[model samples]
Each structure stands twice: as C-alpha cells, then as structure tokens.
Target: MTSTVRRAGAFAGVGSLALVAPLLGWAAAVPFAVVAGIAVLVGDGPVFELFARPGDWEEGRLHGLIGFALAATGLGLLSTVEAMPTLAFVGAVLTLVYGNLAAQVVRRRSTDPVVGAVGFVLGGAVGCWIGILATALLNGDSGVAPAFVVFLSASGALLGALLRSVLFERDDPVVVLSVGLLLWFLWELTDPGTVHDVGIALAVTVAVGYASYALDTASVSGMLSGVFLGLLTIVLGGIGWFAVIIVFFGIGGLSTKFRYEEKAQRGVAEKNEGARGSSNVFSNAAVALAAVLAYAAAPIHLPVGDGTGIAGGIFLYAFAGSISTAMSDTLSSEIGGVFDRPRLITTLKPVDPGTDGAVTWQGELAGTAGATLIALVAVALLDSVGPTGAGVILVAGVAGMTVDSLLGATVEGGRLGNQSVNFLATLSGGAVGAVLASGLGIAAVA
Candidate 1:
C-alpha cells in the first residue's frame, strides 16, 4: 500500500480505539498489546507498517504499537472516580492522535530541524491542552486543576518529542508508553500542597534545559534528561536540592570549556565540543536522583538534628556526595588532563594526559575543589546538613572520585564503559555518604 493508505489506516485504527475507550475503560490496553506482540512474532507486515514513518525499522514498529496500546489503556486507569476515567481516556486519545498528525504536518512543511522539533513539542502541548479542555466541557469535570492540565501538556510534549529522538525515531510506542505512565504517576503520587510548586518547577526546568541546549553545553537528549531530573529535584527534594544539581551542571560546563583549545589539540577534549549526551547526564546524576527520591519518601524524622534530622541527614548527604563526585570527576578529567603530567593510578607510571586511570596532583586538587563546592552548596541550601555533615559529604565525594580512577585503571575498557564507571562512582559516593551520616546520627530536615 502507498504511504497515504498506510497513514489513513493507522489513523483509523487508533481513532477507533478512542471511540470505544469509554466502554473499555482500563481494559482497553490488552487486546491491542496482544495484537502488537503477535505482529512482532509473525511480522506486522502492513499492520505495523501503517503506523511507521518512512524508512523506519520493522522491528521498532512492533514495539511502538505495543507501547501505544499500554499507554492508552494505562492513562484511563489514572483515576477511579466516575467520569474521570473517560475524561482521561479521551484526552489522551485525542492528544496522541492530534499530536501525531501535527508532527507529520510540520515535518512535511519545514526542513529545518529546529523548526521541526519546536513544532513537534508545541503541537503536542496544544493538542493535549485542547483535548483536555474539550473533554472537561463535555464531561463537566476533569478532576484536576488548571495548573495540572498545563503540567500534563508539558509532560506529554517533552516525553513524546524527546523520547522519539532518544530512541532514534523508532519504537515511538515507547515514547507514548512513557508519557502515559509518567502522567499517571504524577496524578496519583503528587501531594496536594505541592500543587503550587508544580508550575515553577516546570518553568525553571524548561528554561534551564533550553539555555543549556542554546549554549552548546548539552545535546537534545541531555537537555531532556536534565530537565526531567531537575523537575524531580524541585518537586520531590525541593528547590534547594535542584540548586545543587544546577551548580554541578554549571561547574561541569565551565570545566569542559577551561583550556578547551589546548585540550582539543592534545586530543583529550570531549567530543562534540563537550556537549553532554543522555548517557553522561544519567550516569552522573542517577545516584543523586535516587537519593532525592528516597529523601522524599522518608516516613519518619529523626529528633537529633534541627531540620529533617536523621532522614534528611542521610539522603541529603548522599545527594551531596553524588553531585560532588560527579563534579569532581568531571573537573578532574577536564582540568587535570590539561595542566599536569599524568601517572597511571595503578602503577604511578608516566602516561598520556587522556589515558584511562591517569592521575595527577593537579587533577586530584581540582577534583577536591569541585567536591568542596558541591558539599558547600548542600550545607548552604539544605537545612539538614551542617558543617560536620558537609565534611562527611565532601569526604565521600573524594572517595568516589578515587574509586572512579581505580575502576578506570582496572576494568574500564574491559568490563565497563566510561558511563558505567561514572555511575558506579556516584553510587559509591552516595552509599558512603549514607553510611557516614547514619553512623554520625545526622538529621536532614525538609
């Protein structure tokens, strides 16, 4: 069949789901998922191809369809209240259908990649907003506030646009599925008091993400992941926690640019002009993010400290340690590689500047400075961590940086990628911080 026929078929198939979604409620996800799975095994042929763009991978189409089926079904189950289920179902259905159509139009009309990206993001937001509003009018209630609607729109746009590119424009269903799941989570898990903070968190995250992209400090995927992380920090850990991550990003970017021309000539400079990708961002921040989540979920507060007391002391310390380690490793690699002669971490033998496991006195000092700065930020902004806790966090960060070098020397290329090493380093940093803080009876208050 021609592309037009395929497109029409996809539209009809997805649109048909929207029409019957009210009746199916949460049960709508299974049949389509089952069909997509069977299509994957037997080969979708025209069935999957109809949802795929030109030159798309055949295998990815199957995954994409399956993801959409799950998302569409899952969204409807977001609330158990009467009319809320149908409202969510129709809103999701129209947002996705209309958003997909808008993206197609923009792609055909504009060859500029920037234009295409903006169109896709804005189109999806507009689609979701319109869908939600229209559904609210018809259903007489959306069971959510206006701010939440905006948040949902933003979430949908970011998830769909970013994931599509991150996944290489294949497996588009993953994007759909992620967006749906995230929306459901937000709807269900958010505290009522946090409703006021939601808008600011989103605005700040988006603005910073755009700035990072414009400055050439972050790739598209990097920006997306960073924004997601930032939003979580602000929403879960509060703006103070978000500030620590921002400081790390700023410091990391500045460090990358330090002695850039010389580092480039020496062939040790970061690729793509030091614009970080998704892998780099995630690896560096994963442990810190986990710490933030744990802090948010802590049920009891310790009585020893002034603020969050024990829980705050523990998780905030871990968050600080992770961020400090990431910054330390980044600065060490970027600045240390430029100023001093390097020695292998394992044998202290002379080595090239960019050699894995290379270490230098200057690099170690730079890493220490980076760790100190992050720990200081935690001390200043977080109520739970004082001078003593900051000291422990700093120590943990330095330890993690040491671990990174040792790992790099021992098993970097053989058993672990650079990103994996970074992740382990951050994880070690957080773990060490948690241990020390708990042992010291530290208390971190919100």
Candidate 2:
C-alpha cells in the first residue's frame, strides 16, 4: 500500500475502535492492548518498520504505540461521559485517532518550526471538531460546546508541537497522544471559561500577535507565545491585565531600537535585529505568568485586608513587579549601550558595552524609568494596586535588575545562561513584591 493509504487505514482502524467502546466499555482496551503487545514483541518487524523513519526502528519506535492504548484505557477508567464510562471511552479513542491523524498531515507539509506550529494548531482544532461530531453522533449527545472544545484542543496541540520541537526524535503518535489526553482532561475536568470569553480572548490575542510579528518586534515563536500568553491573561484577569503585558512587550521591543545603528556599530545590538523569541518571552514573563495563574486560583477571602483586598491583591502586586522587572532589565541593556563606558558590576572596572555584567549611570536611569512606567500602568489599570503598591513594584523591579547584574557578573557566563538569569531576576521581583505586600499588611498570608 502507498504511504497515504497506510496512513488512512491506520487512522480508520483506530477510529473504528470508538464504536466498539460504547458496547465493550473497559473491555474495549483489549484490541489496543493486543496491538501494543504485537508491536512490542515484533520490535523491528516489517509491519512497524514499513512506516518508520530512519533511526526510528533502531530506537524501538513501535513501543511508543503502547502509550496510546494506555492513555485511552486511563481515560476509560477515570473520566465519564454523560455518566457513562463507555461513552468516555469512545471520546478518548476518537480524540487520539483524529488528533494524531491531523498532526501527521501537519508534520508532512514543512520542516519550518513556525509552519509546523501553525499547522498543528489548526489541525488540532479540526481534529477536536471531528471528535466532537463523531461522539455526538455515536452516543446521541456530546454535552460540550464545539467552540470551547476547539480552543482547548488547539492549546493541547500547541503544547504538543513545542514538545515535538524539544524532543524531535520522539514518535509523532506519542506526542499526539499527549494532546488528545490533555484536551479530554481540559474539556471534562476543568472550568476554563465560557465560550464567549474564550472566543473574544482568542480574537484579540491573534490580532495583537500578528501586528507585533508584522512590525518585526517578535519572531515567529515570540508571536506564538504572545498569543498563548495573551489569551490566558485575558481569560483569567480580563483585558486590563492583558494590556499590562502588551505594554511591557511593546516598550521593551522599542527600547532595542534606540540608537540602533550606534549600538550595532558598537556590537551591542540585540541578535536578530532586536526580534524577540520564545526563550526571551518566557524568561521575562515566567514569573508574571505564575502570578497570573495564582490570581486565577486566589481565594475569595484572605487573612488580611477587608473582604476582597487581601484575597487577590498579593498576586496583582507580584504580576506588576515581575513585568516591571522585565521592562527594566531590557531597557537597561539596550539603552545602556549608547552611553559612556560601562563598568563591570563585580569589579567596577570599565568593560565593553555589551559585557554581561556591564552597568552605566544612563542605563540605570533608563531602567528606573522603565520600571516606573510599568508600575504606573499597573496602578492606573488595576484597582487593587494603588500608589503604595506601585511603589513596591518599582522597588522590586530595581532590586531584580540589580540581582540580574550581580548574577551576570558572578555566575551567568559560567554556570547559568542568559535566559536563566532573566528568569531568576523576574522570580526575585515577584518574591520581593509578595513579601512587601505581606509586610505592609496589604495581603498577608494566612
């Protein structure tokens, strides 16, 4: 059989098992288990080898198929659909089958990372739509909205694509299995948000992300990360919170262009002409993202402040502080390049402009300004973060920027990468903000 026919047949065979699930319930695992066993026993056999890429058979790729069966069986055992285990089984099986098939179609089109990511996202949505339709038809009701399903499935697929990029040699089916299971868990177990909220968030994030990409302020992965983070931010905290993140990104990106030609001549310009990527985005935003998640999970009442004050105030402080730190650090490095000689933070000896630990008075001032800008924005937008809270954010940002310099001078070039230092700086900023909030009795922990 041709490769296309083989693929179609495999998808069909696995998908057909969903029908059996409604009848067999837990027993539906038998056929998949038998296939897994055959694959394991045959390891390098022709049936497995026929579809394997170079080095795949040598890595015992067939064994990876076992994960699919295990995932479906786990879903069958744990989740319920319409209070029926059998229908849940059908959903899991169909999700795995369709999601993997769609991912395969995506992977075949290009080797470019951005193309693969875009394809995976679109494919995952299509797969979820199909899975929902199939389940609704087979079981007479799906009990889920297609829009939310598509959103969750796309999120899963994005993760799968990122994982595949990191673990490039892993079998695609195994990666898709993870996506399938996650989509099911998200759809069944969690209350992410309403479809209307998700839809608006998605639309806004995509529009902003595309504009950023077009402006060449962010790379492909940077744009993707922005969309993902923006969507989550809007969903959790609303548009006001999302605006803070965008402001940081916008100002930070623009900072790199300040006297761009001079910085380039000095060999201190950011790589890729100041276009940010995934590593840069995550490093700066990791703590802020954590704070966002914490805000989402915060309790209705806390030990300090009246009613709502302490409950959500602490996370807001941390979020503002972390974002402030990111902006501060970026401006310090970028604007510092055009100033007079910079001294090494550790030795106080003049060094090259771009030296990891270099610092200048102009740069320090610029950093302070950047931090203040973020703090002001936070205070203006968030009712919970008043002037006092903004002060804490400003202090945290400067403190984190100092910590980053110290780390860079001491350990960054040797033991830690630049991204690691950036993450630590943001983390320190968040911690400082939280501690200051507690000390001030704004949001003391219980």
Candidate 3:
C-alpha cells in the first residue's frame, strides 16, 4: 500500500474504533491509541529538532511520551465520565493529535512537556470533580462515570491549549487549562435539581466554549472574567439573584468586547481595553446577607408557597433578585443605548447612551419592567407568589430600582471603584426589594 493510503487507513480505523469505545467498554484505550498512532506517523523528526539537538534521543522521547500521556489521560477521562457523546471526544482527540504534530512541524516550535503534563493533570482533575458533582447534584445519579468526564475535559483543554499555542505562540497553555478547569467547577455548582441536566450542561458548555474562544481570540482579560464569574456563580448557586448578576456582568463584558473591536478598527478606546467596570459586588453581598437575615428572622413555615425550609425561601428570593437585577441592567443598557435620547441618572438632562451614571426615560422604564418581569417569573416558577407575592415583587422591584438609582447617583459615584460600586448598588437594590416584599406581606416577609 502507498504511504498515503496506509496513513489514511490508520486514521480511518482509529476514527471508527473511537465511535464504538463507549459501547465496547474501551473508552480509555481510544485516546491512547490515537495519541500513539499520530506520534508514530508524524515521526520524531520535528520533535527531535525542536526539543533536542542532533544526538539527544533521551530528551526527544521524554518530550513525546509526556505529551502523549497528557493527551491520552485527558481524552480518556473526558470520554469515560463526562458522558460526552462519542463524536465530541473523538473529534477533540484527533484535533489535539494533529495540533501536536503541527506544533512540531513549525519552524520555531516551543513545546514544554512539563507544563503540558501539569496542565493535563490539573485540568483533568478539576473537570472530573465538577462532572461528578454536577451529576450527583443535578441528576441524583450515582455511578463511576465522573472520572471519564474529567479526563475528557482535561484532554480537550490540553489539546485546545496546544493548538492555541501553536497557532498563537504567545498563548499560555497553563493559563488556558487553569481557566477551563475553574469554569467547569463553577458550572457544576450551579447544577440545581430544579433545572434539567441538559440545560445546566449547555450553560456550562457555553461558559467553557467562550473561555476557549476568548483564549483563541487573545482576549485574556475576557477569558479571566468569564472564569471569575463562573466561579462566583458556582459559589453562589443557581438562584435568581446570582443569575441576574451573572447576566449583567456577562452583558457588560459583551458590550466591552464590541466596543473594543469597534475601536480597534478606528484606533480609539485602546487604553480602556480591559474588563468593564461594574458595581455588583457590594450589591450582591448586601442582598444575600439581607435575604439570609430575613429568612432567619421570619416565621418558618412549611409549604409557604411551594417549598418548605428557610433555606428555600432565601434561595428563592436571592435568585429572584439576582435575575431581576441582571435583566434590569441589561434591558436598560441595551434599550437605552438605542433610544434616540438618554438622560443622566442624577439629572434628567440628555446624555450619551453609554455614559456611566446616566439614565434615559426609556432606559428607566425598560429597567423597571425588566426587574418586575424577572421577579414575577421567579415567583411563578417557584409557585410561591400568591396575589400578595406578585404585588410585593412589583413594589419591591420599583423600590429596588429607586434605591439603585439613589446609590448610583450618590455613594456609588462618590469614591469607590467600579466593582465596589456594583456591589453596593446590587446590595442596596436587593435589600430594598427584600424589605419592601417583606413589609408588604407579599413573600412571607422573607
């Protein structure tokens, strides 16, 4: 057989076997074969030149073995436990193998086997842990599958890093792997039983996909922000309030990306290129604390609306507020930006759409409606809101917005940085929302 035909046959055989690994109970072996086969076919020619001088066989083999092991371990875990469909695992493994080959093929190839191994191990461990937690928490299923998910996630990330590095030499594999693992961990935490595993998985996938894409695009700050938010959300849970905060920050990041790209073309807004500044931390913390206190102080009653338990109530309201706040900010900003006219938040005078501390009539109305909708939806989803809860959310949302405006116009703008301001504003708005809801007897005063 011709060399080309032989190579093609080998590749085709690997692909077919990969597709049947799960059914055949050989998921672990697929990654190993693919990695080794690619290494053999690619020869050690470039690998030797890159990592070793003319007579350095020891260095060359060590490097190849390290790369192969890392790649195999990652792919094996992802396939076995993550329960990723066969196609994805196969594709990921193939891509990484090809990437390793390409990297070696390059003129100035710089492959760090040690760094790659570390990334593979760390990323794989984190990914597996997250997959296990998510399956246990969300699916309530118990099995020995999480190990595979971790393996696959790690493998995909390692391959992703290598490919990124080869294509974009400045790209750092360790950073990418770390960020990817962190995102997976956060995704797992938010996998509440109430939500479908598929939905949660999709969200997690989007987060991971975005992180990878950002790395590829060389948006390091964006990637970091995505990782940070993912971690924060996981730490906070899938409650409405935290979701809202995520949405707000997510939108802000997107807005900044758009602006940066626009300015890149125009040679403007270069220095301001980083994560968008926001004031969500204080606001979220205050809101969370208030919810906790209110739930603790209020009369604990079972079947209050839908779920029983003080924890449930707190989660309900916090999630509600988070969603409301996030939507309010997004709708206001997006709509306000398009409105023919916008006004400063402190004053009713016209101002630019993107101006901080600015609010247009259109924006205010949009924001109010957005927050109210989120609250109402949350109440309905939880089946907690009676007529009273509905009314409470309306009142609380308006009150929250009012407080948000007040804080934004005064304390938020006074001295604190953007993060501080967001935190304070979210806290104030959430506190006001909770207080108003409780006072009005809309949501069991919690």
Which prediction has the highest lDDT against the true structure? 1
What are the TM-scores, per candidate, against the unseen true structure? 0.82, 0.80, 0.45
| Residue-level lDDT tens digits of model 2 in 111-166 | 66566566656654555456556656666775766556656655654555555544
Ranking of candidates on lDDT, top first: 1, 2, 3
Report, for every candidate in turn, its global Cα lDDT versus the true structure.
0.72, 0.70, 0.44
Arrange candidates by TM-score, descending.
1, 2, 3
Which one wins by TM-score: 2 or 3? 2
Q: Tell me the RMSD of model 3 versus the true structure.
A: 12.2
Q: Report, for all candidates in order, the number of backbone clashes.
A: 9, 0, 30
Q: Worst lDDT window (10 residues) for model 1?
A: 78-87
Off by over 4 Å in 2: 1-33, 43-46, 57-115, 129-151, 169-193, 259-265, 300-311, 444-446
For model 3, the stretches where C-alpha displacement exceeds 4 angstroms are: 1-308, 338-356, 386-391, 394-397, 411-414, 442-446
TM-score of 1: 0.82
Q: For residues 1-446, could you state the per-residue lDDT of candidate 1 as single tens digits?
A: 33634463375356445544445545645555565566456444666566655553534555555556655555555433333444445545555555566666677777755455566677767766766566566555756677777767766676666665567544555555566555554554345234467777888998988888888888887887788788778877877799999999877976887888899988888888988877899899999988876665554333344434576567877888899899999988998888767999999999887888999899999999999998888888877678988888899889999999999999998999999999999999988888988888774454
